[model samples]
Target: MSSNGSVVPRVTTRTLQKMRDNDDPITMLTAYDYPMARLLDQAGVDVLLVGDSMGMVVQGHDTTLPVTMDQMIYHAEMVGRATDRAMVVVDLPFPEGQIGIERSIEAGVRVLKDTRCHAVKLEGGAEQADRIAAMVTAGIPVMAHVGLRPQNIHVDGGYRLQRDTDRLVADARAAEQAGAFAVLIECVPSSVAAAITDAVKVPTIGIGAGSAVSGQVLVTHDILGLTTGYTPKFTRNFAEIGKAIGQAAADYVAQVKSGGFPSKSESFS
Candidate 1:
């Protein structure tokens, strides 16, 4: 219990390791600011990611790349302040992770110091394994992203899945070997996702990688049905809060128009 007599919230590396050891699924959702972060923490989300996806969800950017390190830090800090129990992980935006080992450490430290996130997630595979190693060695827990890397949208030619099993397995192993605590597999076949999880020691968290992986992660807006503008094939809508909210507002307007709302007893006298 806390000083306020509420149940204190806490998460640690041991908790994450227990999840991996028990094959217990990890739940992660992105939050850009305070209110959402607090709500997610209260709702028992295992991890709260300050993903660069915020560029699209909050800033209206077409891609996550256009977001700057400073912008990431600012949002991360906000989310961190609201987080008491959930493990906070912040994304090292596009080019922020591309500039080799030393730069990666610098970037990781800058973000970590600013936001106090439990770890930092970055996109890479065997090709960038050395950088991942360097970041890990520098005490930054890394969450590797494979398959459809949104930061490389131009090169991947629009978020396609990896069709080659051999390559995917190799990349997963590389990430694990490079000291990542977990890997995020995006837009890969379910069979391939299963194979990768079996091949690696670290937990595999899937976005579009299907149900075969160890755990699942979704952008808060995407899964909560808040995003009405677009939808992805792999994303499942558990609740359509957006539509419900719209309908509720419409109903309120109708009630007012018909003078059915704010009945005499309820009116401010």
Candidate 2:
């Protein structure tokens, strides 16, 4: 039984494969810390991706390129420690796979060893196939990210929708051929997203891409309405948690100022 007093078996790569084969949808959410990871795991999220987007979302960087391996390992460790059943997939930060294949494998292996995460996500498709294959050979499961790679934000002149269907399809096929257990398709049209899903044998996890993929993932902050500005087109705010939290804080401050927070019944006996 888990801490929530329920029994849910640990999710593995093989389990995800079976779910894909059975036509069940996989769910993933980005988690960067222990509290969020624990809560999401208790809620039964299928995968907790320790995304490099933490560079922008958590650390206030302009791009994911600034995130380092040490930062990723630190955050991933907390997420891995908090998870009970959900598979943890940590992002291999910039300059890791973009370098030589050996260094890339080393980086991936370090993430798995240091954080105890189940898999590592790399941001590329065809050019990353060698790194993906090498990592798999070295016992690190790789999840390939195709279309709208945030790590490539500099080259693309900022985040834009990727709709090159032929390139996207080739990348997905290369990643599947390279032994990636899953592919994350991001910021593409529904038609292109669906085409990649059909082309790839492995599970296709969509972000800004559409619903036809085998699974879906989004930044947890976006879904919870924690982000303040510039909402992505594909994400829906399921709850206004940011507003609720602000209101709760305001109420507490008002209560404390009025000395109502320490009422007779609230004091120690």
| RMSD in order of candidates | 2.7, 1.5
| Over 4 Å off, model 1 | 1-9, 248-269
TM of each candidate vs. truth: 0.89, 0.96
**Per-residue lDDT over 1-269 for candidate 2, one digit per residue giving the tens place of the 0 to 100 score:** 58669877899999999989999999999999999999999898999999998988888877788999999999999999998899999998998869899988888888888886899998899998888998899999999999999888788988999999999999999999999999999999999999999998899999988899999999999999998668899999999999999999999999999988989898998
Global lDDT scores for all candidate models: 0.86, 0.92
Stretches of candidate 2 exceeding 4 Å from the true structure: 3-7
Error of 2 at 251 (Å): 1.4
Give the alpha carbon lDDT tens digit for every residue of 121-191 in model 1.
98988987999998999999999998888999998788677778888889889988999888889888999
- CA shift at 68, candidate 2, in angstroms? 1.3
Top candidate by TM-score? 2
Worst 10 residues of 2 by lDDT: 1-10
Clashes of each: 0, 0
